[model samples]
Target: MVTLRNAGLSLTPRNIDTQSLSLISWNTDGFSSRPVSRASLILDHILEGPKSPDIIFLQEVTPFVRAFLLKDARVRAAFLATDAEDQTGLFEDVPFLTMTLVSSERFADSLHSQKQGQGVQGGEDCMLGRVARVTLPSKYKRDALCVDVVSPTAPGAFFRLINVHLDSLGDTLHYRAQQIEILANVLHEPGCSGGIIAGDFNAISPEDDGLIDKNGLVDA
Candidate 1:
């Protein structure tokens, strides 16, 4: 009955010939009484680094937490976030959502698309990408949040990073597979080299082991 709070960060070198990436995953329970405080600690840990991650994945992000992150001077200086703008009240009705934040230093020189939005000045220039919410068929009304980033290893190429909070609880087990399938389809979409899907899968079943491989994605 223990549910994991999920979050992750992926880091790749700017010019190294090696193709390695670093990832950190965490899920902050937005419903907790101290959501902002907890989130602040997590952010502090991520930023205080000998090894700062290039991309950050956050799940169950409440509006307050989102605003706090976007406004934090340190956070805004260090990373470009998917939730940088709340124009049009897109996230107003939702209780919580997922977000992706990429390192401004790493992507500072990379090519950016119109969908990623203009850079904001926060010590460093950060091109905050627009996050797309992919609807799910679950009764819980879950959806995946995603953003595109320029591949550090492959210059001029891009890949997608998806953050998801799948349906939870044993009663919703069937919906987990459907959720995986839908996201797996996104990985296979043309015009990108590949993608990484990470977050709270709510994996409580044995069948979850084979789900990623079945969809042509190897567990990392």
Candidate 2:
């Protein structure tokens, strides 16, 4: 496992030219209610760059925003969690649409799945979203969407991307520690490879007195 240290490195962007693929990850903080607009802005930023990324890992995005992106032809693929509280089944529709666009031609064997548990009081909503290959992997498989992303340019190289958003409220120190533990275990599991654990950690600073120590995380 690779640990990104908070210090000892200059703040310039690392040169990724030698890398076959680049993955972008971020937490959208969906509950804020501006997901649609925020998504648009993010897309703009990504596109503004000279190069496009091969994969994007986003957390805390609502079903509504995912659906909106799927409607656009430019979105090559998407994997998101279903809001459990959406008993009307409206939440599942977005992924279904995205699959129609990406599954056949591009991410032919991609998969998707959601973490168990409802976000809201009703079963209609869920807090954590995950999506993996439509087909399952041979090892270390779970309900979470765990898939291998093979770079088109580099056949033998691959990585695992785990998107997460830990508990944001209550005893933050305790919660962050638990999150680090969970992430470490997941990464250590069999068949796991080098990957980034990206999401809303809610920890503002590395020295924030309350931060927990796990492995491989760099506070920035």
Candidate 3:
């Protein structure tokens, strides 16, 4: 089970002053699960260095890898949305486990899974997907994770951070459309004033209009 702490993250506002908060996302290619030389690249570039990003979004994180990242003190908050749980870690399904997100101010505040259905898993689900969301398709359980934070830049002002991992290698155009619809819905929900949505988008730009123009979010 995932947990949430009552702590708050202090952030730098993009207005008035230079933004202290920065975001970085990467596809580890199963770094945490494999735990090897490539993993060291992450360590050397981000985790071990002093100039680390304030917010981190990682993709292709295996359950084992996410579990390992959770233990590190640098992760301020983690929103890990995974495919269906597999406690055994015996099956190494690549598409079955295409994406997940983790956040850290270098410790943890809270972590939560973003919704699917209107959302996208990697792609397998998209290929066998709904006809106008009537009946759900077979799912690989990909996810979008959301995190909330209050910034020192504007104390008491709250904002949301969203991490996404889209379909890897399938009928991405249609699949991304459906997924963006769900993502747009999440952004438009009441009390959702503003937020950052970042991750692996397998599709091209035209498909992003709904998530942008329709939803009132401009590219950052």
Candidate 4:
């Protein structure tokens, strides 16, 4: 299968009058194998521009990245749902897809709560008034962080933010479909206003249609 080998940055923006609420999704590959640490590079890319996304959804967070986030004063102030503080697993590889959620300092107060996902899927739900994460199912332990957030761009409305990282094996598509089914149930939670699911799904083909519309989900 032709999985998403490299990485991607997906941003969804909504306009409310003159303001906009934008959410960013990215897979960092843990920066495990690299010549130079690219954490700062990614951070600069996210923070340099005025039109930066208000929230960031990250995947494959590593211990090194976690340390940097803890040490950096700016990142510390940004308010995040990272495993930087989690030491439950002493092993080097805590979890392959330890998803993290980040929000601009300006909206620090906007964060409501962070909770783990259902069953054995060790993911999180970063709650932001209008948009919130509900639940998920990842058989291979491919974690996803769900968010309940109020789109700043759409003042009075709410939506869900799902930061997902699916299995990369050959049989990934099958499991991905199952994950989507669980996601459908997640989207039905009371305050959900139709949200976006972004991440590295490890899709097999470029022409592959998600068939998500049947579940009230469409590719963004």
lDDT of 1 by residue, 1-220 (tens): 0112354434332332344455566787888999999999998887787877776778888888988988999877777666364445656667887777766675563222334453222213222233477999786678887665443334444456677888888888678888888888876666445667788888777887667777676665
- Greater TM-score among 2 and 4 belongs to 4
**TM-scores of the candidates in the order shown:** 0.79, 0.56, 0.57, 0.69
Task: Give one clash count per candidate, in the order shown.
Answer: 9, 16, 9, 10
Candidate-wise lDDT, in order? 0.66, 0.42, 0.45, 0.53
Q: Pick the candidate with the highest TM-score.
A: 1
Q: What is the C-alpha lDDT profile of model 4 across 30-55, one tens digit per residue?
A: 64575127766776787688654555
Can you give the lDDT of residue 4 in candidate 1? 21
Candidate order, TM-score descending: 1, 4, 3, 2
Residue 213, model 3: Cα distance from true site in angstroms: 3.8
Cα RMSDs, all models = 5.2, 11.2, 11.3, 6.8
Candidates ranked, most accurate by lDDT first: 1, 4, 3, 2
